[model samples]
Target: AEAYPKVKRNSKFKVLDAADIDFFRSILSSDELVESRSPEELASFNQDWMKKYRGQSNLVLLPNSTEKVSKIMKYCNDNKLAVVPQGGNTDLVGASVPVFDEIILSLKNMNRIRDFDSVSGTFKCDAGVVMRDAHKFLHDHDHIFPLDLPSRNNCHVGGVVSTNAGGLNLLRYGSLHGNVLGLEVVLPNGEIISSINALRKDNTGYDLKQLFIGAEGTIGIITGVSILAAAKPKALNAIFCGIDNFDTVQDLFVKAKGELSEILSAFEFMDRGSIECTIDYLKGLPFPLENHHNFYVLIETSGSNKRHDDEKLSAFLSSALDAKLLSEGVMAKDKADYDRIWTWRKSVPPACNSYGGMYKYDMSLQLKDLYSVSEAVTKRLNEAGLIGDAPKPIVKSVGYGHVGDGNIHLNIAVREFTKEIENLLEPFVYEYIASKKGSISAEHGVGFHKRGHLHYSRSDIEIRFMKDVKRHYDPNGILNPYKYI
Candidate 1:
């Protein structure tokens, strides 16, 4: 990876020395404290999943309990030592790693399933627990976590809360703000705030837990989470539809809502470029449709009866074909068929990166104008002479995302990360989103990469209020500094 511009470290923060190491060594076990400078142990922690962002932190601390985290935070606060709270480190926007030499505080060792109430379907667990494990635990009890992501096996429950992640299941279960009941956070000043309530409805003074839901660990470290779980559907089905143009894609979505009604769980859209990339990445996997189409949609239905749900989905697909809303379609018949259909959708992220590098933009737009941004970007790149298959700095442009929620994932697959391509995309893309009154970032938060670009989505007054809140909670600015407020 090319070296990114360096951010200056805060001079007020004290440099780590032997004395600081000794203090950490006293409170933590030998295995818990990873202070070695060896690249082997620190390599994974230093680089993000995309390998686009890299940090040079010399020390990494793993605390097994909340008490240890509190103590370490207190010491760092008193000494003015900066800290970065990391969980899973699967964040795409570079929020979980250090910018310079800040200490790495990892929550991997604190994973524990604290409690689960089968009657009310409430779950309480440590923040470091993997999302897959939580979902599996709920599945055994006939319940399901409200959230599901492609990175579920690696992403932590707490980390998802910190970013307010909205995954494929979001169209059905809604966002985490509604599912998350309470949180246990350790403030930057070493103060612990525990509001782990599992009640369905509670009209309290102020909803304090909402602050840390998407704060990205700037104000505090989320230690635990209490969330409401939904009952698992008895039957599930999925279908892949191919359409001739974007207009048909929109019409299909509108018709499915009315026809499928309550059984519809997910509606996803993918362009031809995205499917081409997937085919290249996942070789030998059969494409759903035989004929080439401009657009494709993956619709999933979940209900209590398999026979009834299948009949409804079949009728919906048949109607769509009769109306010419779909050119070709295939309904999954078994678990093997279902996985094969979804493999096309879930494999998009890695396929985007199969090229040398990828610049990803996740945005929320109006349903009618969802694909306009991607089209405009492709035109701009071609005009700038930065797009091609060989020798050129660019590879191709693609767009795919959860069309049900109007979130578009626009990816610019490139030969390498170059300043020319970035300069053409930054404010240009941000301005386009702002003009349409859409959020610059949908699921991915404004981490280090999008810090300077927040103005495109937020007003100056709003940013000021956010900064004031940060100062109130983290007076020293020692918690995830040099990032967004």
Candidate 2:
């Protein structure tokens, strides 16, 4: 770290050179690893899914097995190498991306399903196994994992466990943290903790595996995970309901909790901008109406029987429509229509990205306070001439997300804006989130990008406790350092 100008020796993996890569080649399988120092690949790999925090990486390491990771970690521990363990590389923040072209340990080659206990319905997959693959794996059996999301098509289990990822199903099935029973993690000191106990109640000391979840690879590498699978709902029902007002949708959420508690699996919102972008990017997929709505909700439910589920959803929508809560609503006739309705919501971020640059002010507040915050920020941005610069019919920004969990993916797009405006918007957005006593990072972890603003969500005492935990687990400070602090 002292040798490099800006690099810090925070993690156990070292930034190795071409010669360094040559040194490790003999000890490991030659085909699985690559010593990528090229500017193009490094630049591509250094960025995140959001493309907000692009970084520089020196060498990218690909280890195929837990034993290989163990050996690599041991070697890094001895040589003072700082490592950034990465999976899938689909995180919104720069969690998996290298900070300054330091050595990167890619888990892509480690994809495998190590074991599956049918009796307990527990499945353990390698860190590099993509999420969609896991879904297929479960499909091959007669079971399905309850966790579902837009990213499930690409996200991996390792990254999911590392970030404690929550999705639409989180409202019902709960986060992965509660489902994951055991973990096999390679500690910063190069030791493996393989406790594959699938028992529900283990009064084990400390419940150490919890540390790796949502730690963003700062604590250690989650090589493998054991999680309990859930019974698949036999009857799947998807609904796309259009309401003129966003407030009515919020009201519907409160009422639905009382009325359809068990059937309401996911309650998500799609702003007008999100809808238009989906239409624009995905081609002639209609927005389910003659005109656009202020906010749309894609509500879905899974029940024991399709007839009962469809009847209940239809009855629910009828009540809402009769009450003039929504202009129109449709329950999916089949799986194909169900997937089409979801495309409008699932493809928002990607479509938005194709436009140009974007800045995300993701935060978690009281669901009641979410719209008000968005309104206030939208008003402020308009006042600052951020969007007012354009000609007539300026492109109005949009903000919407998992209303069920109070996590909002608020974003701002300026066709051409100054760095000064960027500076102004950052404080305006984060400060408002702070005033609400909300989380600065709702879904995205505090990995490098949001660490500076952690104080907005956590207190001094809580932060101190977190640092202390990091110290206790990795006293050498050789873990993914300078992150999530």
Candidate 3:
């Protein structure tokens, strides 16, 4: 297991014992309980998808219903045992997995679709339902979930909701905070509080559901979700274009928003370093362009009229080319090509990791200065003699993300995970983000990884209020202890 030297297990939280296991076995079926005796089965539950953060959890409970979850939480709270609420276990930050001997409460068994109102375009489902499954279900009904991401197949709706993941379709559908209507969350003390409703407008007191949307399960475990869905677009088109520089990328984005307007679904940006790393990792995947450029942009449009969308996209591309904003471009010929083009953008993170390790920072900066951070980081690492060919700890610093949202994913791919490399990035990256008056974490929640660095993005008063909220919800700090404020 990887060690988090800065954090120690809270003495207030009790260690798991035979009595707790027996109590859990009585409430849950044999299949739902996974004890550490079968380490093989518990392995995946303890490690994160990135394989960078790991836990030494001794037991895992897979509750099939909210009632079962409530019972387990009540007992754990009374016993002062810490618990980690997990779904899909696909979180990049160290939030989903336990840092120490905390018990794992996996939501995999709660996979169920409660209801869907086609007329209202509202969907209600258990938190454990996979995102891909939800998308497929909505597609059949001529409706679509407002959220879309590269990890749709593996990530659960609950996981995405908990992380408040801003994905590829965020430009079109906005964020989960706006799309999600309500939630059924299990508070740390085992109380199941529900704000689940299909109505779009309800100005009754506080919208408590919003708290759990990106809480990372620190105060509660989300068992069900009620979210707004959009009508499936009748037509969809995607284009991959190469740009000469970041300025051109910004100009093209403005042009896309003005020309494509309502039809524009996504505008993603990738720098030369990102493209080179992807190329090296993919190793001849037949890139979209005949030649490489300093930057790449993937644009997509979705609307009810195919002819109108095509004409708008065509006109936009022509003007962009004439203005020299785009050096080269290619429109996806079909669905297969569309998926292939998206792969080039989505495969960046894992591709960078293929070399060895990746130090990822999901940051939000001013549009004009978005790409500058990548350039500055690359130059800094290169000057430090840490980034280069082989035999060096650092491989390269690459940047790519949803430029329309002003979110940039700065990745420092390295030969291995070393303290020295992290030391070089840490306070430096956070401080830079602070200086820009940007968020240290754009979409990814402040997990165990960024818990201590909240000051970079939040003021002392804001953090104090957050801590107060945590205390009001989980007074014992039993829910996801030693993390998140």
State each model's CA lDDT, in order. 0.90, 0.76, 0.90
TM-score of 3: 0.98
Residue 337, candidate 2: alpha-carbon lDDT? 86
Name the 10 consecutive residues with the lowest summed lDDT in model 3.
Answer: 1-10
What TM-score would each prediction reach against the true structure?
Answer: 0.98, 0.93, 0.98
Instruction: Please give, for residues 1-485, the per-residue lDDT of candidate 3 as tens digits.
Output: 35788887788889899999999999999989989876576889999887788888999999999999999999998999999999988887889998888999999999999999998888999999999999999999999999888788888999999999999989999999999988999998899999887488999888888989899999899999999999999989899999988998998998899889999999999988888999888887999899889899999999999988888888888888899999999988888998899999988988888887788899999999898888888888888899888899888899999998999999998888888778888888888999999998899878988878999999999999889999999998888877776
RMSD of each: 1.1, 3.2, 1.1
Whose lDDT is higher: candidate 1's or candidate 2's? 1
Global Cα lDDT for candidate 1: 0.90
Tens digits of per-residue lDDT, candidate 2, 1-485, equal 01223345444444566566766786677765665547676665667776666556666778888988988887776777777788878787667876665567888888999887777788888988898988888877756775776788778888888988787778888877789988999987888987665477788588888878899988788898888877667877777877787779888888777777798888888777767767877887766666678888888887788888889888888888898888878888899888888887888877766655566667898887877777887787677665643541224467878888888887665444346556667777778998998888877677866766777888899888888988776766666666665
Cα lDDT of candidate 3 equals 0.90
